[model samples]
Target chain A: MLWNLPGIHVPADPLYPGAPPFLTNTFLLTIVGSILIIALMLFVGRNPKQVPGKLQNLVEWVFEQFLNLCEQVAGPERGRKFFPWVLTIFLFVLFANWWEVIPGIETIGFKSTDTALSPACAHVGSQGFLLFGQYSNCITPFFRPPSTDLNFTIALSIVTVVMTQVYGFVVLGFRLQIGRYLVFNQGIMGFIVGLFELLLEAMRLISLSFRLFGNLFAGDVLLVVISFISIGVGAIPFYFLEIFVGFIQAFVFAFLTLLFFTLGTTPHGHEAHEEEHLAETAHAEHERVASALAGAKLEEAHAQ
Target chain B: MAEHEPHNTQNSRGGGSNPYQGALVAFSLVGQVGLMISLGALLGVFAGLFVDSKLHTTPIATIIGLLLGLAAGIYGVFRLISTFRKAG
Candidate 1:
């Protein structure tokens, strides 16, 4: 995103002047986030170590956290199968979220050319910035965190929804896959469940997409507002806060994706089965109580 | 023992509470918004059809308009969904 961006040299806005194309702030952040993530993984996983070193250890620890998260939802066996997805999601989002925290990144943009050309950089015989490189930096793109982009978040959410369905197909056959959500072929109940199922899947997409987009976008907007009010120093504290929010949002997105994957594979509406279980359990308890009472009476009679 | 209550589920009941239930609710609200947006889009296309029909263009105009409106609605809905349903 840094390579291409929300720069003055380019259109000030990512969206076309009239069109609501994209919010550029988001696009650039996602790119930078992607680049950093790729670079970090390559660097950390560079050398294969039997004993292990700091880089290897850190990577391993990160994997350990991811694994535990997967296990919580997918369980021991299924989680391992689902590890790759969970890990990928965490890394992508984590990097995007964390990218904004690096200081000097957001503030460190070249002065706008218009501002420089007006009376600003034109200090009488300023000699036109002297160096050619100086002129280029005049409208350089600003580096912001990637998660801050709505496009990136939406893209991730879409991928998450797709995975849930794929897993559903994998675990439940094509027929059950239909049965799991639609139930239309069977009857009204199935149809209702199907509609509800459709709605639930839709919810996953919305929740996963909007939560990340809303949080990150809000953070960026807040930071922008703060910078305007108090200048660079004022936005300092918020930058740190953004980092924390990024971590949480990323974790939540990944975790929910994992949970949804688990649920999509399960069949629709079994509320009655649950009720039946409760009744059986209560009956068993009553039987035990009756048996105990009978034993007590027998014991008393024998003693007499 | 006190903390670990045996709140077990029935055999037919698939393990834990439906994992996607929360996702279902959240996605439903957003999806409904999307649905409404498409519905409005369809209304526009159909309104155009009414103009054609009023001019006495029978069957041809009506059929064309119906098909076009349906196509527009389906396209909008599918497009919105496709973005959110890419492969993992």
Candidate 2:
């Protein structure tokens, strides 16, 4: 049945049994997604024009939207600094998620005939292509969505969290950044709060990784089950749903990264500055309102 | 009316009042809470198991770790909510 859950197989080294090797379906898909992004950027940016064509206009519009979002969330100055990273992350994840919806992604692969290889490969008479003398009931997909894999998402999360810390240190200096996780003063409550903050930081890595992995994996599994139950027709609506979900997930991931970037880059001392700024703005607003009310009263008297 | 105008202007300037942005923020917040709690507990159990194995005290450290994890998870939720509130 096509409804079997995706098996978590340790990718074997194609060369030797104990040889240190690399590259799995997830990695390959990631590489492909990256290449696609690079190609799209090159194609859209090849010609500089006063008025952009359709593809160039589309690409530019997307970038402009993301840039605006970053600026809105992170302020204009820091937004510009982090725009490229956010854009790259969004595009990569967007492509990686969307790639699963393409025809023959998880559906096409060779069957495992060698039962000795693994227990999953023990189904001898099952329907699958004969791949390296192995016959299994189900085919191992050539390209799985990268985000559906825990390893891929964890790697991405690690990089993101590490960058956040790096940016924090750069902006706040080593002492202040360390101070964020460790409190030496302010009594026991302060120390406890600091420990909780540290725990939250660790949890961020887990949350970030698992969120992407769970969403994509669930979607992929749902698609497979639907396709199995009703052939192809019933899965069509779900395919569209998955596309929307893919886009939303990509947006959320990128936006959160941008949010963290903003938070990390803000100095601890800026809280007081921000409060003062807000107070000044409020005072100005109050004066403006008072002046407007006075002007309205004067106009009313003149009319009377 | 005068008092409300500054808040309104500030909201408009912040640009986070849009429905799409709101939805994204809400989704992310939900995911954060769910994962924090579950992963926190799971990590705690594993850590406790490792410690218990080393010290030959099985359930004692495990129970303590689980409680600590639950506390941490609750703290995490509050922290996330406050952060979002501040941002908004």
Report the number of clashing residue pairs per model.
11, 5
TM-score of chain B of each: 0.47, 0.80
Query: lDDT by residue for model 2 over A1-304, one digit each (tens)?
Result: 3343334443321222233345667777889999999998987788768999888878887787777677666776777888999999999999989988999886665554444444556664454344322232345566778888778888888999899998888777898788767887767766776776677777878777778887888898888778766866999999999999999889888887887777666654345468769999999999999999999999999999
Docking class of 1: incorrect
Tens-place lDDT per residue, model 1, A1-304, is: 1121222221223322243565564466666667877888888777668997887878886677666545545566667778889878988898887766666555455445344433333332343432232233233335656666556777898988898889888877687776665565657655654544555565556656777877877887677667655745798889889877887776667766676676665443463357668899999999999999999999999999
Best by lDDT: 2
Cα lDDT of model 1 by residue, B4-83, tens digit: 55564321122333445335424543644464345534554566578777987655676665554455445434433432
> Each prediction's Cα lDDT score?
0.61, 0.74
Model 2: CA > 4 A from native: A1-20, A114-138, A267-304, B1-18, B41-64
Number of clashes in model 2?
5
Each model's chain A TM-score: 0.71, 0.80
